[model samples]
Structure formats: C-alpha cells, structure tokens
Target: MAGSKIVVRFAIIVAIFMMPSLLWAGAMEIESDRMVFQHKSERAEFISNVHLKRDDFELWCDKLLAYYKNSQLDHTEAFGHVRLAQKGITGSSDKAIFDQKNNRLTLIGNAVLEQDGSRITGETIIHDMRNEKTVVQPRKGGRTHMTIESDKAAGTPLPKAAK
Candidate 1:
C-alpha cells in the first residue's frame, strides 16, 4: 500500500538521475539551434543550423530528423540546403539520408558530389562511405554530368633532366 508507493517513488528518482549517462552513447554529436526529442516516439527533430559530426566528417542542414533504436542512432534525414564534407569528398543536395550502420549516404534534388577535383551532378546521388564509391542518377527530365580534371596542363611538358 503506502510502502509500495514510496518504493516506486524512490525508483523513479534513481532512474532520473541516471538519464544523462545513457542519453548519448556510441553515436555522433548532433547540435542545432532548436531541438525536440520524443522518447516514446523514438524520434528527435532539430532545426536551425542543424549539424552532425562524427570523426572528421560533418553534415549540415536546415532541419534534421534522427531515429533511434535502443538508444542507438538508427538513421537520420536532413532537408533543405544539405551539405556533407569528408576527407576526400564533398557533397551538396536539397535532402539527404544517412544510414548509420550501413555507412551510406543518399542525396536527392540537385545532388552534387566532388572528389579529387572531379565533380558529378545529378538529381540523386548515393555514396558508400566505407568503400568510397558513388553513384548518380538523373531526374525524370534531366541528365547527369560528370567531369574529371587533369592535374597538369595539356601543353605542359616534362621538366628537363636535372643537372
């Protein structure tokens, strides 16, 4: 009766004290000007200069929605002026989805990806982070374009033999 209620209250207090330790575990750091998290819904929404960072890569967007499973980040959706930058690659798009476990990122709407000064533009682009591979597809009425740049000028000749 009364004893049971008191025991429940003590348990609740202990659980609340442990929350911070369990909040962010084994996941990237996510920051935004505003954020809302609904634990029961397993979703977190962020707006205004949304940013996500994990290791050397970074993602930025106007809005971001993150889904969680067992407190682990499952995936994320970024919308509006999405941008991603990594060591050897950079990308821009209107929208993007980052799959955490698969280490894949898919961008849509005027997607652009650049690597080693080479660029690809299309309606959609899929990048494999682990393998460093990319695929691009055109919109219904558009076409994809890829251009590679040479390091040296075409007219440049090998340097004369060193003295």
Candidate 2:
C-alpha cells in the first residue's frame, strides 16, 4: 500500500511538471520521419522531413531540435532547407532559430522573406514576432537585396500627372 501511494504521488508530480508546457501554447503538432525525446534533458529532436505547425504558423525542415524549460517551450533550432510560413508571409533559410521567450525568429545563411510579391534576401534576418518588426543583415562583403512590387503591378491605377 505504501509503494502504491508513492507511485500515485510520483505520477501527480510528473503531470504537474508537464502541464505548463501543454498549456503555454494552444497546440503544436509535429510530424517527422523519426523523433527522439529526452525527458531528462527536456529536449526533443525531430529528424528528416520535419513539419511543425502551431496555430497559424508552419515550418518545414530537415532536422529540428526543440528545448523546454519548466515544461514550457524555451526555443527551437531548425537546420537544412528551413522554411516557414505564417499568414501570407513566407521565409526560407539554411538555418533558423525560434526563441519562444522573446517571440523572435532568427534566420541565418541565405535568408529570404517574401510576402505579397515582395521579397527580401540577406545573410541574416531577425523577425520580432511580438513587435512585428524585421531586420536584415548583409554578408560581410555582400549586400542585402529587396524587391517591392508597385501598386500598378497589383492592378491599381496610378493618378494622372498635372497636364
């Protein structure tokens, strides 16, 4: 009877530790060819054609490593053919990191962000999700590039110039 009581208490404690993470965000779904979860380290590794979706955001990558703290999402690292989409915006990079605490996404190496026919490319891109701000950084010897579509391109008529 004592051993059973101890086991019940242990189960309750474990559930308590895991509750915060499950409730911190609405829901996060991940699919991968293989997954390895380490409860002691509070990390999960998803390998090969990984797809992750949370709310309206989606990400695809060859490999992803997600870390947790206090049973809540701490951050995630994505590598190889990293691509992300949310709302109408899309981003691609060689590597990316999503910091849950700060609500920021950092894209590194051949980073490109596109939306509504406009595109920005840089060596590094920092997107602050909470602030809805983005910063692009160029490579050491290269320059960041951006292409913005004009109103006319969207079929909006231009105002006539004074005669």
Candidate 3:
C-alpha cells in the first residue's frame, strides 16, 4: 500500500510540472520558404509575397513576419521591397515595422514614402497610423516633398483599427 501511495504521488507531481505547457500552447513556430514567426498558437502567418489589407491600407512585401501575444497582435516586420498602398499614397522601403498594438508604422533604410505623386526620402519615417500623422526626417538636410505631387493633406490618415 505504501509503495502504491508513493507511485501515485510521483504521478501527480509529474502532471503538475507539465500543466503549464499543456494548458498554454505557447510560442508557435512558423517557417516557410519566405518568413518565419514564433508566436503563440491561434495566430495566423502571412508569408512569401505577403499581402495584408487592414481597412484602407494595403501592404505587400516579399516577406512578412508577425506575432501575437495574449490574443492581441503584437508586431509585424516587412522586408525586401516593402510597399504600401493607401488612399492616394504609395510608399516603398527596404523594411517597415508594423506595430498593431501601438497603432504605428516606421519605415526605415532608404525609405521613399509618396502620396498623390509627392514623395519624400529619408532614413527613418515614423507614421502614426491612428492620427494619420507622418514625421519625416532625412539623415542630413531633412525632408522635401515634390511640389507637383503634394497632397496638402493635414493628417497621416490611417485605416480603421484592426480588431
């Protein structure tokens, strides 16, 4: 009887130690020929010429990697010729960061963001997708938009927040 009791206690201890891993299917590993992500389960992966449409914003890229934490989207990184089409504006860059939880996007590394035929080039461009505000700062002399294509738009103008 005492031996049986010891065996039962050992089984219970082992189950308790494994409970967390069984309950939360954590850190999903997604790998394809293009992109890879390590996010929790229940998240989706868009890869290999990814096209993501959130409201008015349409993003296309050679590779897109995204993650979700606690059921809320955390971040996304688009690489290798990232292009964005929204309203009358189109932007292209080597890389772009899409922070869904923060409602912002930062285009980096030789980024050219254009709207209504007007374009700006800089090392870093931070856009507040929520308020439609764009801050463009060139590495040296700052930013300049093509006069002929200037939209004179007041806001940065992002799409509706993704749920």
Best by lDDT: 2
Q: Scored by CA lDDT, what does every candidate get?
A: 0.77, 0.82, 0.62
What does the lDDT read for residue 99 in candidate 1?
Answer: 93
Cα shift from native, residue 81, model 3 (Å): 0.7
lDDT of 1 by residue, 1-163 (tens): 2212111121222234334345443336666777666767777788777777877888889998887665566788999999999888899999999998788999999999889889999999998879988888999978899998776766466689989
Instruction: State every prediction's TM-score relative to the real structure.
Output: 0.75, 0.81, 0.61
**Candidate 2: lDDT of 132?**
86
Which RMSD values do the candidates have, in order?
10.4, 8.3, 15.5
Off by over 4 Å in 2: 1-22, 153-163
**Residue-by-residue lDDT tens digits, candidate 3, 53-108:** 66577777776766555544567778888888888888888899988767899998
Per-residue C-alpha lDDT of model 2 across residues 1-163, encoded as one tens digit per residue? 2212111121232346566334433557777777667788887788887888888999999998988787777898999999999999999999999998999999999999999889999999999989989999999989999998876755777798999
Of 2 and 3, the candidate ranking higher by TM-score: 2
> lDDT, candidate 2, residue 67?
87
Which clashing pairs does model 1 show?
none
If both were scored by lDDT, which would come out higher, candidate 1 or candidate 2? Answer: 2
TM-score-sorted candidate list, best first: 2, 1, 3
